[model samples]
Target: MTGTAGDVIRIAKSQVGYHEGYSGGHWTNLQKYSPAVPGLEWSQNQAWCATFAAWCFQEAGMPKGSYPVTASCALGVSWWENAGRFSDYPGIGAQVFFGSGGGSHTGLVYAYDADFIYTAEGNTNSSGSAEGDGVYLKKRARRDTYVYGYGYPSYPTGIVTADPAWKNPTAPSQQEEAVALTDDDIKKIGRQVVTGANGAKSPDDPTVEWAMSSFLGLTYKTARTIAADVAAVKAKVESLSVGGVDLDALAEKVADKLAARLAE
Candidate 1:
């Protein structure tokens, strides 16, 4: 199953106390995360703040292309920026980048308030150094100089970001919007329905049908009855022409006006 922002936070929270192991006369970053990402094994024992963020996203079931998987914080920022998913505001489960140009360190943002942002980071200690020891949760000021920005992941469910220009990821497509009818438009459509100009003998447009059925609460039988009534009225109006006025045109205009009122 696809995971949510909450899942990413939970997985990162579960690794709060993980520390690197010592091997081969060095602090070998012999951790479970390095091998999980391709081309990241070489970063073992190096700064792994970005690696930790990548692992959290991976374990949370975020598909490879949906989120960045890298060891360099700068590269991660570039990845999000290139995809137009980078933001200055914080979001839950977003990858938080820190330091100069967002290259020095990285972490996962679990929460944020007006004044502070909370994070789950690896290779950090009480001092909050870029290259420190184990996984730790830290709180930093929202306007801290080291805090650069955020990299939002395109979760399968959706993405909620503070940027107004960015729309909801799962919103209906443009094709769906095209079928949305206004009251005036619906009244015009009603005239077509009554006149059989909407191809009553052929397969109806699904969108038009849905608009009539769902919005106007019209059924097939109800539409046929309306057509019959209109035809009868038009026939009666044609026979009652006064002076030189075109009664047929007058009747059609009156029917259109009545249809508009009825739609309301």
Candidate 2:
């Protein structure tokens, strides 16, 4: 599986303040995305908005050579279109492209509504121009000039199982990291349980995929396909609804069952 949209957004959000400058730090960092151009020089003149987007995909675990590392917004759009993922409206995490100086500019879609869209863009600033000075979040109306179509990356929707070759025995389960489950988390997990019980399959449902992978140690595919696994998930959901079962105990039981299934 490829990186999640969550992974892309998290990585992009980490670089919000990056700026083009004489110091060359941002330039050198973005250069890592384009290793094929050996000994590339750092330059403020170089347009890096697209490179920044590609780098986020890379850092989010997009396989090398699967995505093109280009500085051209048009090229990025071309790739997504060729893959049949281009669309007129922007989706969350879609790559928003714009025309600039006979070329193009781009950013990641953060959110949108009927009137406007918000973005996390690099090499831009408060004014939101494509050729602005640094990385900054910007908002624009939907009908803004130069608003080219979006390039949607094919983010994985299933629980991304670790490769057996790369799985780390020491990694902690998602429940271990939470310490305490919030009402929202429990409700969300319960929804996933109901979905599985009903035998629903949504390759684009990130929340359930996350819960299945992180809390239950099951992939979306595995949880939905295996009857016993679905029954276990449904039982937990019923326990949550009835309000007497110990969540911690149920979590452990589900995890153990899921881990056994994974072994099969």
Q: How much is 30 displaced in model 2, in angstroms?
A: 8.9
Mind giving the per-residue lDDT tens digits that candidate 1 earns over 176-260? 8788789888677675674364455433456556555564555666677777877877676767765577876886887796697
> Which regions of candidate 2 are displaced past 4 Å?
23-45, 100-102, 158-264
lDDT of 2 by residue, 36-56 (tens): 332223422577788788877
Instruction: Tell me the number of clashing residue pairs for each predicted model.
Output: 0, 0
lDDT (0 to 1) per candidate: 0.81, 0.69
- CA displacement after TM-score superposition, residue 241 of candidate 1 (Å): 64
TM-score of each: 0.64, 0.52
Deviation (Å) of 212 in candidate 2: 37
Clashing pairs in 1: none
- For residue 170, give model 1's deviation from the true position in Å: 3.7
The TM-score obtained by model 2 is 0.52
